[model samples]
Target: MTSAAPTPHTLLTPGPTPIHPRAVQALTRDMLGHMDPVVFALNRDIQQGLRDMYGAAPDTFTALLAGTGSLGMEAGFANLVESGDEVIVCANGSFGHRMAEMAARYGARVRLVTAPLGEAIRPEDVAAQLDDHVRMVAVVHGETSTGVLNPVPEIAELLRGRDTLLTVDAVTTAGMEPFHMQAWGVDYAYTGAQKCLSAPPGLAPIAVSDRAFARFHARRSPTPLWYADLDGLRDYWVHQSYHHTVPVNLHYALHAALSAALEEGLEVRQARAAHIGQAVYHTLEPLGFRHYVQDPAQRLPTVLALRLPDGLNDAAVRAELRQREISVTGGLGATAGLIWRLGLMGESARPAPYRTLMLALEDILGVPGLAGRFTETLTEIEDAVPA
Candidate 1:
């Protein structure tokens, strides 16, 4: 007899996470005028929620761009870096390299401080690249490619009292973890709604400190890009001066997502992510799976990468999971086929998806006895999950 098929696929992939019900309902709302009072209220709440989630100071200028996470990266680089400016990019994974590329696009002289995959870049290594000429220091808070969570707080600390501005791609970390950008003195940080906020892709929420705004306004070059220009975005988001037609409908979904997150509270959301992460590590370690990331503490709770077990086919195992109606992804760049990335993000971080994943892994890894063990291991995780 065939095993029971796990129908109605559960999404367990990082980014573009399973959309929350509130977000889905949010999309069904009638569209409003961009300058409408209701929209302005939504814009205020979204911007405020972004500030609170990011740990931004009250004076920090925050806005949402109608694009994916990559566009936020471009806006951050373009607004700050100009011709002949020097920027330091901490490269530990694919996103870090993307930051360097973005800086180069703006004609900044980019210096890269890189580390091995699965290893977080050292603060000292980042400090080594610092000089008076370096105008900005960019790092990925959660390097999803390898599931390595960089030391953003320490890196932010290193830039303290220095002239170099700090920018972070918190695409995979922001709503799921404590970003601490204001406390860390980060000048600029950006996150997408898709990853941790449980929203569909499109809106990128960003926070920029007063100092960063000062630098942006002081730029020698006139803002070259119209759509993504921070100055125009600020005018629209802050003063309600029309920039372009603001995304009215996407705002509905994104606002509901952020509202759900705020309702859940950051501390609780973080704990939920941690609860799921512990269960994953607990199941994998005994099954003899090796972590791609060296330090467990440096691992991202939202995104986890593990080496594929010996004798297991990459496509076959993934296909098996797919047949079970579970959606997980593989590695990218140099780590492809060597590791698989499982996302425990937002609504996907809940126990049900993970229970299926664990069972699937047990079957795929040929551990028949793990069925009993999995049940025992998840009791603690189950207790913490909200009804």
Candidate 2:
């Protein structure tokens, strides 16, 4: 007798949301050698896709690093920072603090410009801390931990005409929202494939502006990390010389994912994310849930974090959802046990998955009409959104 069919799972966590079907198909295809001419063509296509996603200049350098988003973050600091160089890190959520920690490890004089947890960093606050000595300013476009969408464009504007370069962590916002690196003057930016791109994890796509590349070349000391060295990476990505074995299958998945994203249009995805955010907020508000981030403008539509009601058991609820094959994450670090992060990204940022979530929550919470309310809210949001 055949065993029972495997249970299907719905993923709503901030990272590694449901992989797009095209990417899944791509993953199952036959592999290619790292240095195959076909693989090189695929890589170029992926680079062009990334350039479009970030609105980068034609000459901006892009590469798919074989690691998670954190590697991209580290690479940004590893190449541009040196001992005794002052670097300003804008910190609000867990990821921002992680950036500060990474910068400190690189021997830079790390200056942290902070906001309260669950709040976005203020550009003016960052501006106030800037000085000629500050070599670079690092900021997060979407803080996954707290769902705060920091104003990178405004912060980039603040650094204009300064000697300082601006680096952005766009891990959660890249394909789901507007991110024009060239227009905003972002010197460097990076994102993971698992987030808005709806590809499998283990790939970090990065873009380096010409200015940032010049700074990379002008470093006072040799880059300490060989793996993350931008110059070495450029040799592999642009010059077609092997620095390491490229993850050909992962690139295949990313290529398909990018093709799907460009076909659907990024602005349409952004609107869908906004609709999801509104549906979640309105549907859960009646059940006594409130947003973790108070300011709507500062909240990320891609990741809506909600403060759990008093006396609610976070772990128990999440576990129940998990049992039903739905995955949602709880708070991290300082906000532990207080918030639930519901990711509406890429393939998961649609009505079907959200309806599944609402039904499960209704069953767990004993709210008789929660699912119906969610459907109504979703309808209202869709009607309001212009075609």
Candidate 3:
């Protein structure tokens, strides 16, 4: 017998998070020309929304680059790193290594301060590696691969009074976590529209401090190429001059997503995510599952990395969940075969996905009655929040 086309899965992976109906609706609006005044205004609104969310300084430049988060990562490096200059890459997981790789491609001397897969990078390790030649310091705010939130504020403080630029990869945590760009001293911060932003994948939103722009302005040579050049992007996004044609519809969608987040209030939204993440921990802990990141403070609210017990078939469990149109993921790199990654992001961070996913996990893992137990616990947690 043939089953119907698979139902829309509750997207529980980190990237390309579940988009809100409002954002999807925005995508269906009439397409505008890139040079249209309407699109220019929408693009400007998106950039302004980003700056407001980050609590950035007045001069901090915010814009949406065409590609996804990785493109922003490259742009961050391409604009700043020159040949033979030094950069400190903080590698506690996959994204950090990617930053280092981008720096290398731009001919910067790379120094890595990495922790184990499930641990956060130490601020002192970053401090110990600093020197006069270090032109930039790159760190991932949320290391999704390990479910660890790096100590970006502490790391930023370490770079205080130094001439080095501070760049953060906030792809997974932008809207879900508390963002304090001005107070945090982050020189250049970037996030993808896919994850916490809850928009369709494509746009890379970035915030750059004045100091970082000066470094780019004073570069010894022109930045690598036309597409991802920060200077050109700034001219178009900031000055409203025609640099390249943008994805007009996606900008509207991105604007919708950002506006929805801001309307909910960033602090309120972040607190809700925190509550939901705590609820997940409470629900899963009783079923003999242990989190990969031991320190609670180091964990990311968006992604849950769980360590299953012996004899459990990780693939089979994921397959069972997939059968029900649930889309939790597994680990990568050093964590392969050892963990399951359940993403609690944007729309998915609410109770519905958590309820469905926990029940499915109970059925797969043979945890009798634990799903019922989880429902009760999560209900109490949610009830505490004032609607």
Tell me which of candidates 2 and 3 scores higher on TM-score: 2
Please, what is the TM-score per model? 0.94, 0.98, 0.95
Error of 1 at 53 (Å): 0.5
Q: Model 2: per-residue lDDT, tens digit, 1-387? A: 899998789898998889999999999989889999999999989989999999999988999989999999999999999989899999898899999999999998999999998888998899889988899999999999999999888898988898889999999999887789999999999999999999999999999999998998898899988997998888878999989998999999999999999888988999989888888889888778899999889989899999998878999999999999999899998889999999988988988888888889888998888778888988988998666
What tens digits encode model 1's per-residue C-alpha lDDT throughout 69-147?
Answer: 9989999888888989989999998999999988998899999999998999899998898888899999998998999
What candidate 2 gets wrong by more than 4 Å, as runs, is none
Tell me the TM-score of model 1.
0.94
Worst 10 residues of 3 by lDDT: 366-375
Which structure among the candidates has the greatest lDDT? 2
Rank list by lDDT: 2, 1, 3
Candidate 2, number of clashes: 0
Pairs that collide, model 1: none
Tell me the spans in candidate 3 whose CA falls farther than 4 Å from its real position.
Answer: 1-6, 383-387
Error of 2 at 187 (Å): 0.7
Task: Give the Cα RMSD of candidate 2.
Answer: 1.0
Instruction: Report the candidate with higher lDDT, 2 versus 3.
Output: 2
lDDT value, residue 55 of candidate 3: 78
The true-versus-predicted C-alpha distance at residue 359 of model 2, in Å, is: 1.3
